[model samples]
Target: MTTTHGAHGICLSLLSSLSLSLMAALCSHPALAAETDSAPATRTLIQAGKLFDAHTGKLRSNQTIVIEGEQIVSVGAHQDGKPGDTVIDLSNATVLPGLIDAHTHLTGEPKFGYEELGISTPRAALTGAKNARITLLAGFTSVRDVGAPAYADVALRDAIDAGDVPGPHMIASGAALGITGGHCDNNLQPYEAHAQADGIADGVEGVQKKVREVIKYGASVIKFCATGGVLSKGDDPEASQYTFDEMKALVADAHRLGRKVAAHAHGGDGIILASEAGVDSIEHGSYIDAKGIATLKKNGTYMVPTIYLNTWLLDNADKIGLPEFYLKKEKAVAAVSFKNMSNAIKAGVKIAFGTDAAVYPHGLNARQFAMYVQMGMTPAQAIQSATVNAADLLGWADQTGALDAGKWADIIAVSGDPLADITLLENVQFVMKAGAVYKNNVAK
Candidate 1:
C-alpha cells in the first residue's frame, strides 16, 4: 500500500506539472506570444569618443548610445549593438546633448525701417520653416520661441510636431501680451494712425483677456512685455509698462492654466515687478540693478539675458534697415546690457541662455555662449544654462536637454571638446534628433 501511495503521488506531481505548462501556454496567447517574440530592435548605435553629461557637467569617455525608435534605449561603455543597427562612429568627435535656444522668433524677422512692410502670416510661416531647418542643421534641436507676430509661431510649432515640416522641437508663446502703447504693442504708428497690434491689452481686465486669448490659440508659454523695449517705438526702455498688480494678474492667470510666464523686461522696475509677481523668467534684463538682481535670486526667477542682440543690432543696424530712432536706442542700450548682465551674473542670479536670434541672424545663435562666458559664467555653466537649465524653464526636462537613457536622442557632435573651447559649439559637425541623423560630416 505504501508503494501504491508513492506511485500515486508521483502521478499527481506529473499532472500538476502538465497543468502548469498548459496555463503558461494559455497566458502566452498569440498577442502575448508576439510581444515576447518581437522585442523592439535597436535602430542605431552612436559610438562616441567622448560624451557630454549635461546632468553633471562632465565628460564621459568612450561611450556608446543605443537607440530604439525615437528614444535612447541605453547609454554606457558596454552598450550592445544589435543586428541591422546603423552605427554612427563619432570616435573622432565629442558628442554632447543637442543644443537648446531659449529665445527664438521663428515666425518673424525684425523689421528694419519699414514697419508697415512686416512679413504676412503665410510669408512669415514659410520663413519660419526655412529658419527651422537652418537652426536644426546648426545643432539647436529644441527652441523656446519667446514671441511671434500674431499667432504664426503657434502654427509653426504644431507643424514641426506633426512631422509636416522639419524643425527643432519648439515651445512657443503665440504673441506677447502687453498694454496699449507698451513694448509689445505695435506703437510704431503716428498718433493719427488707428492700427494696433493684437496684444495691446490695457489695465488688468484687458491684460487678462489677452492672456486667455493667447492661451486659447495654443500657446505653451505666456510672454508679456513687462517694460518698454528698444525695438518698439515711442516707449521708454527703462520705464515699467505693466504695473505690479497687472503682472501679478497675468502670472496668476497663466499659472492657473498650467503655463509658465516669460516677461520681456529690460528695466529694473520691470524686472523686479515681474520677479515679485512670480513670473517664470525675465527676458533681456538689460537694465537690471542690485535690487532687481536680489529679487530675481530671492524668487528663483531665471534671467535670459539676450546679450548678443545689442551687439548684433549695433553692428548690423544699417543692413537690417533699422530706423534712426531704433538705432539710437540700440546704441544707448547696448553698453548697459553688457554691464547689467555682468552684474547680474556676479550677484548670483539664475541665468538661462537666450539669444534674441531674429534680432540678428538665426544660424549665429551659438555666439551667445561666448558672451555668457565673458559675463563670468564658466564654459560648463554657460552650456548648462542652455541645456539643463533652459530645459527646466521650458518644462521639457524629462524629454530633452540631456544624453541619458530614455531621453529623446537629440544630440550633436563637434570635432573637439566644447569644454576646452566653448566656441567649438558654434560649429557643430553632427546633428541628430529623435534617433534620426540629419547632419554628419564623417558620413558626408
Candidate 2:
C-alpha cells in the first residue's frame, strides 16, 4: 500500500511539471508576448471653459480637447468623453496654447563674477535638469537652449526625450560661435592661460567650419555672438564682434544645413549687420536704432527682445554678485533697453518674447509678457509673440504655436482672462505638454 502511494505522488508531480512547461512555451510565442506587453491606448479629454484661439489671437468658450498618445486628436466645442477616457475639468480656467521661450540657457542659472569659474560642464548639465523642470512648470512647454559648455544641452535634451527626466521640448545649440576675446569667448583669464572658448572662431572660413561642426554634433540651431555682451569681461556691448563677411558665412552655412541662426546682437550696428546677413533672430536688441529697425523689417528678421531682465537685474543686483564692470554694463543697457525696445515695437518690427532667464531666474519667464504690454504691445500681440511668433522662429509652427488638431498637446490655463490682465499668466493654474499634465491646480 505504501509503494502504491509514493508512485501516485511522483505521477502527480510529473503532470504538474508538464503543464508548467506547456504554459511557458505558449507565453513565449511572439504574438502572445506582444499581446501581454502592450498597454491600452490612453485617451484624455480636457474640458476648457475658455480656450484661447492662439491661431487667431481670440477666445472661444466651452471647448473640449481630445488627446491620444502624445498629440492632440481633436479640439472643438464641448462633447462628452466616451467610457475609459480620462477627463480633466478646467471649466473654471482659461486654457491657452503652451508658452514658448525662444531664448534660454538651461545649463546654468544666476551666477556672478568669479563664481562662474568653478562650475564645470558636468555640473552645468545637472543644473540644466533642475532648471528644465522649473521652466516647464512655469508654463514654458517649449524652449530653445541657445548655449552650453561641451554640448551639455544636447545630452539634457536627449535625457528628456528618453523619459529619463522631465523637461520642455528643447531645441539646443552647440557652443555659441564667436571671435577670440569676444562675448562668447572666455576673456577673463590673462595671456598665460590661453583660455580659448569652445566657440572661438575667426574669419569667414573658420566660422563656416564651426557652424558645420556644431550642427554635426547635434545642434538644431546655430547661435553666434554678433556683438559684445554685458556679462562677459573686457568687452563693449555696443561693439560688433563678427564682421559682415563672417556673419554672412555663418548664416549661409547654418541655412544650408536647414538650421536657423540666432545672433546675439545688442548694439545697433551689430543688429543691422546681423539682420542684413540673414540671421533668423536677433537677441538682446538693446541698442537698436532706426536703421536697425528698418533692417529687421526689410529682412523679416524676428527680434527676441529679452527686456524683462533689466528690471529683475536692477532690483536684485546685490544678490546676484555682479562685479563693478558687469554692474556698470547692466545699468547702461537697462537705461536704454526699454526706450529702444518700445520704439522697435511701435515701429512694427516683429517681436518675440525672451527673458535671458539665467541672468534673472528661470520661472519668471512670464514676467516678460507684462513687459511687452508695457512696451506698447497689445495683450494679444504680446501673447502671439510668445506663441505664434516664437514657433515660427523655431521652425515648429506646424507642431506647436496653436491648439490645433495635428499639433502636440501643449496647453496651459490661468484662473482669469489673460486679455483682461496679462499678469494672470504669471500664476499658471494648469500646465500640460505632450498630453502629460505637469501641474494642474484646477484639478487639485
Candidate 3:
C-alpha cells in the first residue's frame, strides 16, 4: 500500500508540473502576447462641441476628428468607433486650428544692457530649446524664426524635427542682413570688440552677397533692417537704414533664391521703400502712415504688428533695466505702435499675426490676439490672421493653417468661446501638434 500511494503522489506532482509548463508556453505564444505587451492604439477619435472653421470663419458643432498617426484622417459627425480605436472627449471645449506666430526669435530671451555678453551661439541654441517648449505649450505650434545668431534657429529647428526636443514647426532665417552699424549689427559693443555681426555689409552688391550668404546658411527667409530700430544703440528709430537700391538688391536676391524677405521697418518712408523694393512682409511698421498703408495694399504687402511689445515695454520699462535710449524709444513708440496696426486694419492692408515673442515673454504670445481685437479686428478675423493669413505668408498654406482635411493636425482647444472673449486663448486647455496630444484638460 505504501508503494502504491508513493507512485500516486509522484504521478500527481508530474501532472501539476506539466500543467505549469503548458501555462508558460501559452504565455509565450504569439497569440497571447497581448496579455503581457499591449499594442499601441492606431486610431483616436476626438469628439468636440465646437470647432472653428478657419477658412470660412464659422464654428462647427459636435464634430468627430479621426486621427491616424500624425495626421487627421477625417472630421465629421459622430461615428461609432471600431474596435481597437480610442476616443478623447472634448465635447465641452471650443476647438480651433493651432495658432501660428508669423515672426519670432526662438533664441532671443529678454536681455538688458551688457547682459548680452554672456550669451554665446551654443547658449543661444540652448535658450531656444527651452523657449521653444514654452512657446509650444502656449499653443504656438508653428513659428517663423526671423533671426538668430550662428544658425541657432536652424539647429533648434532641426533638433525639433529629429525628435531630439520639443518645439514649433520653425521656418528659420539663420541671420538677419544689416548695414555695418544698423539694428541687426552689434552697435552696442565698441568697435574694438571685434564684434561686427555676421550679416553686416554695405552697398547694393554687399547686401546681395549677404542675402545669398544668409540663404546658404539655412535661412528659409531673408530678414533685413529697412529702418533703424528702438533697441539698437546710436540709431534713430524713425530713420531709414538701408538704401532703396540696397533694399531692392537684397529683396531681388532673396526672391531669386525662392526665399521671402521680411524687413524690420518702422518709419513710413522705410515701409514705402521696402514695399517698392518687393520685400514680401514688413515687421514692426511702428511709424507706418497712410501712404505706407496704401503702398502695402497696392503691393500686396503684409503688415505684422507686434503691438504688445510696445505696451509690455512701457508697462515694465522702469523695472526692466533698459538703457536710457531704449526707455526713451519705447515710451515714444508705445504712444503710436498700437495705432499703426489699427490704421493698417482700417485701411484694408493685409495683416498677419506676429508677437515678436521673447521681446516680452514667450508663453504670453496669445496676448497679441486680445490686442488685435482691441484694434477693431473681429475675433474670427484675428484668429484668421494667426491661422490662414500667417500660413499664407509663410508659404505653407497647403499644409497648415485651417483645420481641414489633408492639413496637418495642429489644433488647440479652450474651455470657453474665444469668439466672445478672445482672451480665453491665453489659457489654452488643450493642444495637439501633428495629432499627438501634448495637453488636454477639457472636463472629461
Q: Which is the leading candidate under lDDT?
A: 2
The alpha-carbon deviation from the true structure for residue 427 of candidate 2, after best TM-score superposition, in angstroms, is: 0.9
- Off by more than 4 A, model 2: 1-40
Clashing pairs in 3: none
Candidate numbers, best lDDT first, in rank order? 2, 3, 1
Residue-level lDDT tens digits of model 2 in 35-132: 78886787999999999997788999999999998899899999998889999999999999999999999998889677888999999999999999
Better of 1 and 3 by lDDT: 3
lDDT (0 to 1) per candidate:
0.87, 0.92, 0.88
Give all TM-scores, in the order shown.
0.90, 0.91, 0.90
Candidate number that wins on lDDT, 1 or 2: 2
Clashing pairs in 1: 112-321
Q: Positional deviation of 186 in candidate 3, in angstroms? A: 0.4
> Model 1 Cα displacement at 202 (Å)?
1.3
- What's the true lDDT of residue 12 in model 3? 86
| lDDT for model 2 | 0.92
**Candidate 3: tens digits of C-alpha lDDT, residues 300-399:** 9999998988878877877878889778887888888788879999788899999888788789999989888889899999999999999999999987
